[model samples]
Target: MSRICKPYAAIRTFLLLLCGWVPLLTALGAAGQTRIYDIRYGNNAIGTLETKQETTGSTRRITLKSRVQMKLLSRMEVDIFAEYRHNVLHAAKATRLQGKSSADSKETSTEKSANGYTVIRKGERSILHHARITYCVSDLYFTEPREIRQVYSETLGVLLPLKLAADKRYELTMPDGKRSYYRYEKGKLKEVEISHALGKAFFTAREGA
Candidate 1:
C-alpha cells in the first residue's frame, strides 16, 4: 500500500463494518434490502476532508446476472461478475494471478483474472475470504483496490454500537459538517439520527426509490 492509499484502505474497512452490520440492526426488515456502500475518508496534500456514503436506491443487490468491471493494469482490464444470494457464491471464470500488491505482506492470495470471475464461499460458516477483486489499473502502477465483505451472524447483536436485535436497530458514524456521530436505537427504526458537531441529521428511506 502506498503512503497515500493506506488511509483510504482503512476507511474502506470502516465501510465494511457500516454495511456489513446494517442488517444486524433489530430495526431492519427480515428480508427487506441491504446496501453495499463505498464510503471513504482520508487526508492528502490537498487538505483534510471527510466524505462517506452508502449505495442507495438500486445496485445494492448484485444478482445472478450482475457484472462489474475491474481495470487490471494500464491498458488492461478484468471483469467481475457477482452472483450471490443468502450465502452461497460462485464466480464464472475467476482465477489466481499476481498483482502489484501480490508482494504485499497483507495479501492472502493472488488471482489473475482474465474473463474468469472469482468465488466467495458461503456465509461466515464457510471461508473467511469474501473474494477481493482488483478495481482499477493505471500507469502510476498502484495496487489495485479490492472489495471485502464478510458475514458473521453470531457476531450480530454482540458487539456494541452494532446491532439491536433481529434487524431491529443499527448504528454508524460518518462525516457530517465538522465531526460525525454514531446513531443507534431500539424498536422499529422510523428514521435514523446522525449527529454532527453542531447538531444531528435524520433520514428516512424514500417510499420506493
Candidate 2:
C-alpha cells in the first residue's frame, strides 16, 4: 500500500514541476530580453504632455513601456502608462534602417526619429524593416477638435472626420485609407478637439463607452 502511494506521489510531483515551474522558467529567460517603460519627462510640462519612453539593453531580450503625461493648456499633468509589449527583439530591431534609434527618449525641440524601428532577436542586435516614428504633434494635439486632430489621428491610424463618419468603423476616405473607425464614449460620439496645421479636425467618439 505504501509503495502504491509513493508512485502516485511521484506522478503528482512530476505534474507540478511540468505545469508550474517550466513556464515560470521560460518567462524568466524571456525577462532578460523584454522592454522597460518609464516617463522620462512631464513633471514640468510646457503646454501639453511632454513625456518620453526609454529602454536599457543587457543581453537576453528587448524591453519596452509606453508612458505619457497628459498635459493640457499648460495647467494639469496627468502621468499615465499607455501601452507596452515585448518579444525577443527590441523596438530598435523592429524599425531601423541602419543604426540605433533615439525616438524613445531624450526630449528636445528636435524632430522625431526617421530611422524607423525593427523586431528581431535581442541577441541578434539588429532590425529587419523600417517604420517611421511620429514626427510632430501640435499644441492641443492630445485633445481638441477634428481638423486639428488629424495629425494625432494619422500617427494612430485615423482619418479626418469630414470624409469619414463618426458613427461606425470603416476605412478612411482620405489618401491614406485603411480599416479605421470612429471611437465612442457613453453611447455618444466623443469629440477630440485638436490643434492641427489645417485648423481644427474634430474626431468625435461613437455610441458606446
Cα-based TM-score, every candidate: 0.25, 0.20
> 205, model 2: CA deviation in Å?
13
Question: Residue 195, candidate 2: how far off, in angstroms?
Answer: 27
lDDT of 1 at 62: 24
Give a tens-digit lDDT track for model 1, residues 1-209.
35434433333222222112222121122233332211212111111111111222322122111111123221111222222223222222211122344332121112223433222322222232334221111100111111212222111211122223244333332222222223223222233333333333333322321
Give the runs in model 2 whose Cα sits over 4 Å from its true position: 1-149, 152-176, 186-209
Residue 189's C-alpha lDDT in candidate 2?
A: 27
Question: What is the RMSD, in Å, between candidate 2 and the native fold over all Cα?
Answer: 22.2
Over 4 Å off in model 1, which ranges?
A: 1-83, 86-161, 165-169, 173-189, 207-209
TM-score quality measure for candidate 2? 0.20
lDDT at position 170, candidate 2: 20
